[model samples]
Target chain A: MMPGSLRAACVAVLRRDLLLAWRRRGDIALPVLYALIVTTLFPFALGPNDDLLARVAGGVVLVTVLLAMLLAFDALFRPDLEDGSLEQLMLAPQPLALLLGMKILAHWVSTALPLIVIAPILASMLHLPAHANAVLVLALLVATPLLSLLGSVLVALTAGTRRSGMLLALMLLPLCVPVVIFAAGAVSAAQEGLPWIAPIAWLGAALALMLILAPLACAAALRIAIDA
Target chain B: MTAENSPSALLAARDLTFLRQDEPVFGPLDFALRAGEVVLVEGDNGSGKTTLMRVVVGLLHADEGTLYLDGAPLDRDLARGRLLFLAHHLGLKADLSPLENLRIAIGLYGCREAITPQQALHTVGLQGYEHEPVRQLSAGQKKRSALARLLLVPADIWLLDEPFANLDREGIALVNRLIERHVAEGGAAMVTSHGAVTFLHGEPRRLRLSA
Candidate 1:
């Protein structure tokens, strides 16, 4: 934990980030909508069989949430880095790790929080088994922040590049595989009436690992982005 | 911690070199800035005026050489605490109100004894416009809003790249006063600008870079 002053600064950044997401509603809302629409389309694209839907629902919700997280990743720091807010942020006395954490925190609140709240509803639309749906939302609540935190680093890495969004997806999609596998696996295991604890524990561990390392990576990448 | 009472250069750089996109930007250079002194970095576009400041401020490390702040070797985090950088881009969050921006900035910097929003706004000549989103402000007004952070935080060194490029006469005057006030408070500043600013209390030594 940082001193109160630095913590306050991080909180300030988090607040501003959340407020901006509120003001632009569409930036964050669109991704949640994308997740919902994509999840809903699975039944139509495949078939109306409840048994098939139950088996596929976990993967559908997990994949859609992953895509939704990526969609909003661009908003993390590129604008601030390009427009000079990054320089101000770098110049501030607060540690870059803490400052980056604040942005990641903000991103989770706006993007992941909504996804968690809405995952249950989307799961029902997919005809997911009730037990599996609970596991799906729970896994997401634990896993989505990991995606945002790690994805933010990749976003920072490609910050000033010509094809940043494409580059970010290329770099990040691979790293996100574990999260997808573990989170979706948890729900799938629940659907099969197997204990889902192993995958859930893995997801929790991955989230903790990401929480520790992602801020440092994002801060270093931000320095590169600004220099470039 | 390096004691302030010791006779030392607040900022010192030796043979600093920076490379951008495989092209040498500036340096293999040396310089020092002491308390209350001002240093002027002069160069045309793409000549690395911004790059040099970035390196000095420890946002970008030099390809060669070493930097020192307050008699200690400069690290990114330590240097960040000692220096303030204002870049050519205004860095304003267009969607955020001016007060929101300043308060957020102060928060991000972890400035204790940070000024109230009213004081920061008044200092930047933005008194009545605190609640308006920065995007709604004019170019000069936006710049002022960006600069409002200076009043909210206490920094030992100021690195400004083109502090007056897009300002009106009044804005320029305001910038001058701000710089003068910063110096009066025993702080040092390094800046790059297009032309002479007559209002700086002391003549800053000029260093020019050629592409």
Candidate 2:
């Protein structure tokens, strides 16, 4: 038997996922729309005061993006799990962790990247100061992938469970706390004119750590989840 | 049941037992699948055939006993790319065209020499439907799209669970032809079916599991 090429397998996994996301482009739009709607609702509910909106804008956008990502995260592995594509991926000659990492990368691209692309607009909508808005974007840039990496493991762990959406959120809350803290801390520090690089650095460190570990964890979790 | 334990068998298992919640799904089972052979895992619904396939594919671990690949302890790393498994779930992305799906399979499994994805699709009787999304194809057509992988990927062992489930008479014949060609080319296949349809000629080996 010819040994499968890791490069070819990685490209295949990435292309398959991206193509699937394109075919059902509505799904990619869902989280973006959700983020938009949630960001739009804040000023209305919190009253039209610029000071109030600016003060709360960074935190609100961070939480909204977090919740929006959570909304889209359940799908990271569910479709593949149901369709047995994931099984094929597992049996492929390449390391399952590497394939899963590609999947997480694709998921981040389809779901979180869109949200991040619109973050500046979202932040501006809530009257976030321009400097703090840049920090918010920077924070999300490092943070969303961190959330995606963390969320993927939880999603894989709950994969075999029925209606795992709520269970996913509950299980992820504790893990997401640190991510949220660091991200929001960065934005708020920028707002207060304090150096925000420390919190951004923390999130980057965590993202770098999860960048190596989450896929490995997710692969093991999926293997265990599908054991029945 | 017979356990030939051929020294040159490409794949063999000894006393393989799997437990579901600590209750044995199959116990102390033994079999050897040599190259250029076809083994039919015949059993009723819930007879652990699919579970056995999944176990051999390394998705599920056996509670007890060992699996050997080429007379050595089955190392999953080494066994991959050598075993091809086609389960009830065809694994074709419903949204992708069959050609694209086949390309992904070839990309992951590595292509058999000289066989293009288009040629494989045409060989599987999916020529005109090559660009049709798998979701729109009939159930039988979806199965054929998956069967095309057998032609495009270079796996020495094929584990096909319920290969006949969604096929018409012609599709069944196509499967037999594929298996015969695979075995003729020195590859082996283990097919599981519970129905009473006629199988490949030459009295292929049967491994039965009682529910």
Candidate 3:
């Protein structure tokens, strides 16, 4: 029987994911550092002129951060899936959607949430304007979780595909385009002192939609993935 | 959930069919488990034994057929608690200690009468080694840790796929004892294996799967 208490199952899955991240701290850190390094290359490649870097920094940071999240995403369910913990999760009486939601939330905490927290320091390195800096981080705080949620669905969908990392990026980058555009556009509008409410609202809408549907997709994908 | 008042089969599969990449795995398959009965599923290599087990557990939906648990359609939620399945892959976390692994397993199964962590350790024959990481354990020891899961909790039906895969003689004896105890208690089980199981008390109903 599925647990009478859905909330308890959700909490349980969330705790399990967090524990996984904690135990495999090295694997988790490598991706985070990879993101940091990839983001750091922007100024060096474009020359150190602060104004020139600032002009394109918003898009660069958002795209790079989104890429970083995608890079780490294949790791999200792959290890568990390979090791068969995924089957246990699937067979748990709790709704797979709810359990997947807990996992996505944990992914956000460990991946996107940390990215948002670290955005400020990276933003400074990119010479983002003061107002745009806050906007960039705020937009990322809102946006990256959406990326994580969507990435999770694709990761689950393509769970055991050969070269799944590449496939995941192929499948998710297109889906993530809107999030990348709206997030970077929000910062861009703020940089020009224009009302960026439309893009922010769009980003929020994307997040809300993904929050609702991604887990279900992930559950269905898990069924197929497990077979593979 | 289905009404407990109904005298429904604990597990049933009707006309189940499954294919992998266009190759027929199992077709027109039918099986059931009643209270106090054990079903021994036997087959040769590549004969869909594991696939049949997966389909029964709802891990893989049959390409064509219906399944029911306790008179209810094998709803994923209901099956979760009603079925205790051990796949070919032991599913033990390599990094976690055995005790930690058992705790996660208990939590996932949501067993109301779950044994204490210590009892689980003792039942698995790992009383002093519960704290040792799974990566350090021998294959048979890890298999024992998984079998211990059966002792710590109860389920409506048990599905074991190659449960004796890597066990030593003693480990095999212990597993047979566990199965005997479970059957003696009136629980149902469906196990698949390539070799004959000699210790079963009664002639278990047999189902053969072929590629």
Q: Which of the numbered candidates is closest to the native, going by highest lDDT?
A: 2
Pairs in steric clash, model 2: none
- The top-ranked prediction according to DockQ is 2
Error of 2 at B211 (Å): 0.6
Interface RMSD of each: 2.7, 1.8, 2.8
**lDDT by residue for model 1 (B61-88), tens:** 6888888777677776566666778887
Question: Which segments of candidate 1 are over 4 A away from where they belong?
Answer: A1-4, B1-8, B110-115, B195-202
Give the worst 10-residue stretch by lDDT in candidate 2 chain B.
B1-10
Q: Tens digits of per-residue lDDT for model 2 on A1-228?
A: 232698888898999999999999998989889999998988889899999999999999989999999999878888888888889998999999999999999999999999999989988988999999999999999999999999999999988888777888899999999988999999999999999999999899988999999999999999989888
Candidate 1, residues A52-122, lDDT tens digits: the string is 88778888888888888887787787778667787777777777888789889988888889888898888
- lDDT (0 to 1) per candidate: 0.79, 0.90, 0.78
Ranking by lDDT: 2, 1, 3
Q: Which candidate achieves the best TM-score against the true structure?
A: 2
